[model samples]
Target: MINIANTKTSSTEQKNTPMAFLELAFRPFFLCASFFSIISLLLWGAMLNGSFTADVYGGALWWHKHEMLFGFVSAIIVGFLLTAVQNWTGVRSLNGKGLLGLFILWLLGRVLFLMPVNLSPWFIILVDITFLPLAAAALAYPIIQVKLWRNLMFIPILLIMTLINIVMHYSIVSQSPQLMNNASTAMVLLVTLIMTIMGGRVFPMFTANGTQTPRVNAVGWLEKVVIITTLVALIISFNIIDLPTEFKAGIYFIAAVAHAARAFRWKVWVTLKTPLVWSLHFSYWCIAIGLLLFGVAELSATVSQSQAVHLLTVGAMGTMILSMISRVSLGHTGRAIVASKLMTFAFITIILSTIFRVFGSYFLTDYSQVINTAIVFWVIAYGCFVYIYLPILTKAKPGY
Candidate 1:
């Protein structure tokens, strides 16, 4: 297990704050992300049931989607990258006051978006969108110092995501609902692309390590096909280029087959006995299944686009991120990388939640009940995360 304390931190920071949690990137950010997951779901459920609404400038549904994607998920991405970049380059990323400042900026954006205060759309954009580029800047200096050109790919993705967010806000400003929807859809595809890249890097490696098996290898041609086809599908999905649905479906179907082929080569079945390992594999499978459904939905009138998207969002992205944050938190905090019983249960519950959210619409006549059931499962999953890790994240790292 990798320990955060083993990372190169100076003695000045070691003694600067009694709150050792602020001394590293993952501590506060992961804690906040997990907490926000719970709160956001509950509020979204209430919005679905007509109990209450958010105070944001966009409609409640848009606010919910944006916050869940950008507000909550982005925190995990930044936290993981900040922590990982240090290990990659042997240089400090963010620590002490700098991390705290970033966290505060994130909190400010969330508050401005959720509260009833009358903030300008441009103001929200300014506060909310600053976090990603700033995070990229923090990582860039170290990566450049090490002359790691490949690692620089993440910066462009961050900038693109930031651009999408700005475009989303501009859509709100102009009251163009379709534009807002398109921008949000683009953001989702962009995140999925990032997940595809990261999952390709880590899933097979983790499976090899955990299962004591030979490293699962990627097929060179398959990787290239997936990247090219997924980019095409994303462009078509963006709907900004005015592509035909038939063309989008064809590209999406090809992307789906390629992703499934690659994932199958990873031998995920061997990971079943290990919750931590299997969760990663299972979530990857979710992406493959989601993409297949996404393509079919474009071609078939019977399948709902919402279901396919949820399969990716809730089943794949949510489950993968939750498992990762849990695993990484445990490893970095000087604990065993093994998942606890509660954590295992959390993983299972989230997978079940994904099933309900993604497929329940087809099974049941009333969609609201499906949403309610899925929300309950989501709460349980994230609640377990907060229950298990809240104290660990706040306290000093072991031997600090």
Candidate 2:
């Protein structure tokens, strides 16, 4: 659905940029998202150890969950979409002062959430909910101008995420922890759906190009089944409909099977030699496994929902974000797409972090230690990214 082939910036469009970093949405958003993720994770670890105390709005736990989704992940999603829409429609997206204003708007939401000064809950909600809609508008304009109807699906998804964010804030005002948890789970499922759709588009293409293999053709029926089942699972996760546990479990299992089968057609085995390609395959498998485990959690007494969620969060989302940003940054910036040695190690560490976060509770007696260890791996993984990519992100692309 994305026109990966049409990524070159026209000279006329390039003339509008005042600075390199602010020239494209991906530059600032990716940099900020990576740094914020590390800071958020460290604060989370400190919160677990009882060392960090901040009078963050919505309490610490709620801030951690909400910020990771609406704060960190949302930034990356906006960045990727805005940048990709340019390629899809051959229309320039937000850039220069306009892009900076949007970035500042997003930053204000994150800052207001953690500021020690007491603030009206309504004011914060207004600031936070405004980013996505504006971003959706920025994204929608280009597609509509070019009549790229197929790419328009992302606008509604962004608006829906904004709606979920509103519900999350309302849960805090209502003092309903259950509602907050449900909203968070729904947000996670919604992100998984985004990943599912995007991965289906790019994984086979990336794998084939990286490995010099023939691209696998998608079966129309199977593709439809995958999207339909994922939508059902997402609806169930929202807890809007009162579905039985068995019925919910059945939907999850069907989604899981559909994802796994769809992934198999992507030629995952051949990607192992290429970290950039295989990391994506590994992350997609995490989604499939996470969905299956989610079904098991619903049906079985032993498996907790939290464990499955960590797999999707730390494994699927974290790894995939790192992989995508790494590759996208290089390609867009006019560099070769090869992963550096340190970057490759970063990829491996993130995968380890996911494994520990998801399975460590089952094998280890001390849950705190499991979480701490997972945090350490995560820090190392993302730390490598910041260290290696800082210069690449800040400096102008060679000969630009």
Report each candidate's C-alpha RMSD, comma-separated, in the order given: 2.2, 1.3
Which has the greatest TM-score?
A: 2
> What are the runs in model 1 whose C-alpha is more than 4 Å off?
1-13, 16-18
**lDDT (Cα atoms) of all candidates against the true structure:** 0.83, 0.89
Residue 17 local lDDT, model 2: 78
Give lDDT: candidate 1, residue 198.
83
- TM-score for each of the candidates: 0.95, 0.97
Among these predicted structures, which one has the highest lDDT?
2
Give RMSD (Å) of candidate 1 vs. truth: 2.2
Give the Cα-based TM-score of candidate 2 against the true structure. Answer: 0.97
Candidate 1 lDDT by residue in tens digits, 192-274: 88878888888888898889999978888888988888777677766767777787888878888988998899998899888
- State in Å the error of residue 321, model 2: 0.7
